[model samples]
Target: MRISRLAPEVATSRLIARTSGLLTVMGGLGAIALVLGSAGAMHPGAAALGPVTAGVGLVVMRWGHRIPLSGYRFLMAAGVVDIGVFAYASPTVGAAVAMLSLSAFAAMGSFLFFALPCALGYLAELLVMGAVVVVARGDVDAGVAGVLAVLVVGCAGAMAVVAHRAATAHEDALTGLVNRRGFDEALEAAVRATARTGEPLSAALFDLDHFKAVNDSRGHAAGDEMLRAVAATWTPLLPGTAVLARHGGDEFALLLPGSDGGSALACAEALRAALPHIGTSVGVAELAPGDSPADLMRRADAALYRVKSRGRGRSELDAGGQSPMARDLAAALAAGTSGGLSVHLQPVVTPADGEIVGVEALVRWTHPELGAVPPADFVPVAEREGLIGALGAFVWLAACRDARTLSEATGRSLFLTVNVSGLELDDPGFPDRVLATLAGSGWPAERTVVEVTESLVEAESTRSVHALHVLREHGLRVAIDDFGTGYSALSRLDTLPTDFLKLDNSFVSAITTSTRRARLLRSVMALADALDLILIAEGVETPEQARALASLGCPLAQGYLYGRPRPVAELVASLTAADVVDPPAVALASG
Candidate 1:
């Protein structure tokens, strides 16, 4: 809650919380010994000191929880104290207890940050006690001693199983790809490594094209089948050893290690060509060393939107096939040029009213040589390289700057919504960052929308929901972007903090061809109405598509029909010139 609760401090808090429960039990034992000894019910010697020592452990655990930022360290300290208490109270019993404790420690090893150290401490304690026992008894048995060792090792094995199960609980039941938390962790790790080594890493963020339409026409079973099919298709095409994670619902990411912008692009292209029936919009970015996972994802996602803009089922490389200026921009990003990037906004309009109610802020990189590089090419790299936090901060500043300028120029309270990476939501500093940025920019909080996807909400914790609530508390609105693209349960929708639903474009694209898709759209509209949430239909390419979406009660629309994303000056000019313009002579333009 305090400013000091940032990064390293929070890491400390996590350390303590994890081990506090175990310490509580030990502390109670020590307290009991102290009580009995004082009351003359137990000997005033080391042998009668176990319960009192345990009580002391409980105090440490209690303190650990309160500290909030030193959880891991506190827990490790607790383990050390346990060893000391046991040694003083009763050496023989302490050795046996150490073996039992060691097992529990091993079981929680994977989840605990200090597992190895805790295990070693326990082992050390056991060895010391073992020596003490041999000296006191002068006898070593072949059967009983072996049995004791086996029991201790067995306890450690049991603990390992417990930790493994705990880790797996958050995994996607169908694809074995890292779920939301897992993906966040993997991305964060990549970012940190890239920063440390200055190696280019990338993230490919994509979703199945026309996936919802498949579900609507074939049934939920078929939709699930399609997802599994796509995952199967991509399994091999991904670089032989990359961190591929299912990012909740339909979205998946392939984290490339030591990959350059070009290599990452090649990987995206291969993935795009592998799918036979379904297509995907692939966004790729070369992670800048020192970037946060959130920042990297934002860049990757921005690149993906460029692909979506170019038309789905395609891949956009941050460096390839760009104008000279664009290429220069890519080069500058690779060289770690500061102030080389900026943000642009694409309007989401009401098909019926044609009023610019909201705009999605997209980031763009302007390398000194390349001019302007699309976000898709660089965002993935940022997420993988752990620069996502910096990327998010940059986007926040740009979006706020544009929102203010738009309001001032148009005399309209334009709502500016920005897409956020899942990793951003998991950062404890995210909510605070949002509040501070908004305050600094003097932007109206209600006029700002934070767009998130269903996959992220589903993969993340109740904390994601809580974070959204916190954003709302600070007056910012939240929208579920790319809806119908992920397998979000109805119950989840009921619980998550969402003010709007931005329906995925694929469903809108298929409305004219599939009755099932139309029906699904109708149902979504109905649900939105029931929930009193605004519905923004994306990818409205044709007039017919626009009409169909409006007829189905989708109040807002975005896509080529409205306008392609452009620079601020161009966007302002287009807004001034908007009219009930005739649709393009043709309805559907194939990519």
Candidate 2:
């Protein structure tokens, strides 16, 4: 039973136990001194017992550090021992000595227990001390017992206040869930328990899909209300052993003791079912053989990134196979610092005349052993490992330089589109960084288009919105890439500062196969026209798809039909061979 209850004590309880231990030790020693001083030579047994009890109390205080919860009980036991010793030694010593010992109990009781329990314990101690005083028939002040009672109550009240403050410190003020600090403490404790018991432990990280949009569109107050509603709804659904915490912003973390990956995923699905309107991406990772809290969290975060990358409203379990990739990526990034990463460009053209008007920059990584690691595999790894920022900056700088060179060589104003990570778009300094890169590369902002995934529209925070506006103010164009593949609504296109919408390849793939989908494509084109935004169709893999896109009045298109992603030299050479001396100005006249 003791082992079962040996889970880590909360921060508040630990603080109280430590304070109680110190108070207990002080109370024990003070009792001994008062008795010795008042008695003017204590009884041999009393002198031996007093110091021995005090010494034992000090030892217990030290032991509390290892098992804080158990230590709390030990401190309580020490208090009981002190009272018994004082009761026994009171007759030989004066009643004043007994009263002093009772006062010591009052101080220790303050932090020893909660208000009701502490009050009851102190009241019982007072009764024993009062009886001792009556039996001793020594000149004890009649008012001392009442004064000590009041002191005990006051101390207990103070302890309550301290405990409340400690709890508040660890709680999220808005959501009433554990804050990040509390989550860390709880995760450490959970990891230790899993290590000791060899039980499966899992961590889940949840990100609310498009949460920033909620804050941006409905106002922050409504966002706060939504967060609180989520917490209140989901808190009751968690198991008793699970720890739910707000992990800053629109994310929440769950620590599930004795649960494996499968169970954790189930919990996530259950949460999704409960809050159907509020989409969440959940990542689950079970504890490994030698996993620390940080390792577990990193894995879970990686899994969450995968979920978000694939599409937001789902749960994913970490395969725990990224250690090699993580290592290689770290090494690659280190090497990339001295010029290892490179960019390739894919031409975006008008299907009507196949004229190259813009180029989309794609990052490439050629590993030493792994050869060319695909962006799909390493890009998410970079985002998870905090290397995305550096990698993105490198890509932006290289793309701008290459685009500038290509335009100079062609003597034309060919636009360059660079894919920006959601992290980069959300960064406040991203607009400034783009401007700095453009300044260094001599690439005009008007010739640069920042391409972001459709998720950007959903996760549009105020800062991100402001950043987009700032980028546009500096004459940089913004386009939503992979449009139909994410949670973007056609009606909401005007809400974002988007100049172009690139239809996802999935939709393009369906355009030729499904008549219903072809109609949807036409509607999308009409909506883009209505919104006065440029529409671009991606993955026009065949003449048929391109012909269909043209018939649908889609003005811009990019796919293998034009050309695959190639090195800048090859792309420029191909464009030059196609007689592209200047940016093409062909307009589609027919479907």
Q: List the candidate 1 regions with Cα displacement exceeding 4 Å.
A: 1-340, 367-372, 576-591
**How many residue pairs collide in each prediction?**
61, 1
For model 2, how does the per-residue alpha-carbon lDDT over 343-427 read when each residue is reduced to its tens digit?
Answer: 9988888777777888899999887777888999988777765467778888998899889888877776678889988766655
Q: Estimated TM-score per prediction?
A: 0.45, 0.65
Give residue 198's error in model 1 in angstroms. Answer: 18
TM-score of candidate 2 relative to the true fold = 0.65
Tell me the RMSD of model 2 versus the true structure.
Answer: 7.8
Residue-wise lDDT of candidate 1 within 354-398, one digit each (tens)?
A: 667667888877755556656786775555444567778878977
Q: lDDT (CA) for every model shown?
A: 0.64, 0.74
Pairs that collide, model 2: 551-591
